[model samples]
Target: MAQPPSPHVERPGPAEVRDPLVLTELKRAGVWAGVVLAVLGVIYLAEPLLLIIGGLIFAVLLDGGARLIGRALPIPRGVRLVLVIFLCLGFFGWLFWYAGTTFAGQFEALRQTVEAQGAKLLGWAHTHGLVDEDRPQMVTQQLVGSVGRLTSALGSAIGVITSAVLILALGIFFASEPRLYHRGVAWMLPLRKRDFFYRLLERVGFNLRRLLFGRLLGMITEGLFTWAMLAAGGVPFAALLALITGSLAFIPNIGALISGALMVAVGFSAGTGTGVWAIIVYFAVHNIEGYVVMPYIARKTVDLAPAAVLAAQLIFGALFGFLGLLLADPILASLKVALEEWAGVDPHAEEGEEVASPE
Candidate 1:
């Protein structure tokens, strides 16, 4: 005789929980508690994480630049990579060998120049009724004190040379076998969604590479142009100003503004005519870079808003100090890419579309 069919047992759907309300509430509480613990853990790991972030950025630069050169040359990628690394190291070595002593002296001179300029400006302000004469000393003391405290805080957070070394080492290792790291990260995702995550990673990586390329190109061009113009006009501390302008150019929007102000101040200190020339050179160079070059490149890459970038810098800078400030733009870009991918939001989607074209 055929056995009776086993009794059917209906399984509850995910949205249908048969557990008591108290048990559900306890589960929810446990989840929230776990989240809090995770946040605290992150805070504890902030130092190492910051260094890792630094390494990641450096690796991206190396990999991106090397890839570009490899595409142009007949040489193997590994050989090209070695060449790129050595060239970078050699450039830094030569730079220090050439300017180490002079740079130190120039740095001191820059400090003195800024101090003297501050005094001169204050006096001028008093003379022109821009500041109250009787309260000048008080205002100066307050501003100087605030700046000193802030600098001290920032310097401490940066730790020292050891942190720098750690970041450098990590970066080189990451660059050497980036695909391993890529695969490791892919492994962490759900198996079914691994392919999607891999694609997201590629898109995000390319976006980061493009952003960095644009920034690097801008830095080099601006620095060189500024140096050429200043040296031609015989401006004092031309080398130092060029260095400042170039390094600062790494930051978006406000970076140019700060560099420009510093140049103008130093320029005016030299002479009225020199100041006017510096302003003209700055406006011309940046206008070309910002309007023509940046737009063209951004159209091909990512077009981040100035306000959004500036805000990220300010927030991150306050939270993690220097590393935070440095990595803010890349962090923002990566987040944007991840969100767009996960949310299925088409960046180029038309306003009235029911289903966006994947293209």
Candidate 2:
């Protein structure tokens, strides 16, 4: 009675095509395989992974700089980024060209002064009975052995150069298409998780940007103040010392110690008066930075405890050496952010914003 029966359509069997359960199983397997591969990759190619992280950090720095420039001038972010990069390159280039000749001489003098100081200190140690005169030969042997190890270790300095190049290239690429990469990272998470992760990334980016800004400001302030003070006080190699101090300031606690010691030693190389002035300048500038500038900035951003940072530096330094020490604070900060979110804690909660209290 009805119209002619609808034409029969052949459906493919599970074997001929695919089954839903089988597809789901396959997807799970593929995901597990990917996870395993990634773990293995990190273990085997740690240097490259570190370089990638370095590149990301560098990109963050570039992005942060561009944002500051953007606030001052109305321009496209891309153009601003390019200008910031060029400005940075120009600055470094000028620094190198400006001080190349002096740096060579100063560095040589620094080496000789360090050796002289070392001998003087050792003699003092012997006179003060800090060293067992009975084992004088042992002390010399240990010194020579340590020097040998250091020189041998420097043989791998080429690896550092390669890593720098890798970081630069990767940073430029990442900075160029940040949004694309950011979205791609979000896409890797489940739909429900993506939103939370997106917000997490936003906070991280903001914190890192702020952290780097504070760091840059502190470095410049310390370096310039140091240079002016030292130069005015007639400290030899003032510019070079300031440059080293600025570069090392990025490394936090250990860096300050090293820079301060180096500057003091260099200062003493000239005279007692110069040495005293250098020490005074170091204390004044760094105290203000450590107490005033850094505290104000950290309250606004990183908020990491100094002791905790030093501990992290120790752990990361043992695990990954110099680069780890450099990145320890940021890594710890990111970890803190993740933990707070996981624990359902509000980082910026006010007094009235407490969820629970003694009623």
Number of the predicted model whose TM-score against the real structure is largest: 1
Which 10-residue window in model 2 sums to the lowest lDDT?
Answer: 350-359
Backbone clash count for every predicted candidate, in the order shown? 0, 0
Q: Which candidate wins on lDDT?
A: 2
Provide TM-scores for the models: 0.84, 0.81
TM-score of 2: 0.81
What is the alpha-carbon lDDT for the whole of candidate 1? 0.79
- Candidate 2 lDDT by residue in tens digits, 1-359: 77874569676665773778988998999999999999888666755666788899888888888999989999999899899888877886787687776687778888788667666667888899998775556776787775454333123668666776778778878988998998999888788777677667777888888898888888998899999999999988888889999888887897898889888888888899999998998898789888998998888896889999999987766556566777888888888976665555666887545322111
Model 1: what TM-score?
A: 0.84
For model 1, residues 1-359, the per-residue Cα lDDT tens digits are 99875679676677776669968898999999999998997677766787888788878878887898988898887887787788777876786676776687888787777667778888988999989977678777997775454333236534655676777788789988888998998888778787777778777888888888888888899899999998897778898889888888887776788788778778888989988988987898789788977887677666677789899988777666666777788889888877777776656558754322223
Deviation (Å) of 91 in candidate 1: 2.3
Each candidate: RMSD to true structure? 6.1, 7.3
The global C-alpha lDDT for each of the candidates, from Candidate 1 onward, is: 0.79, 0.80
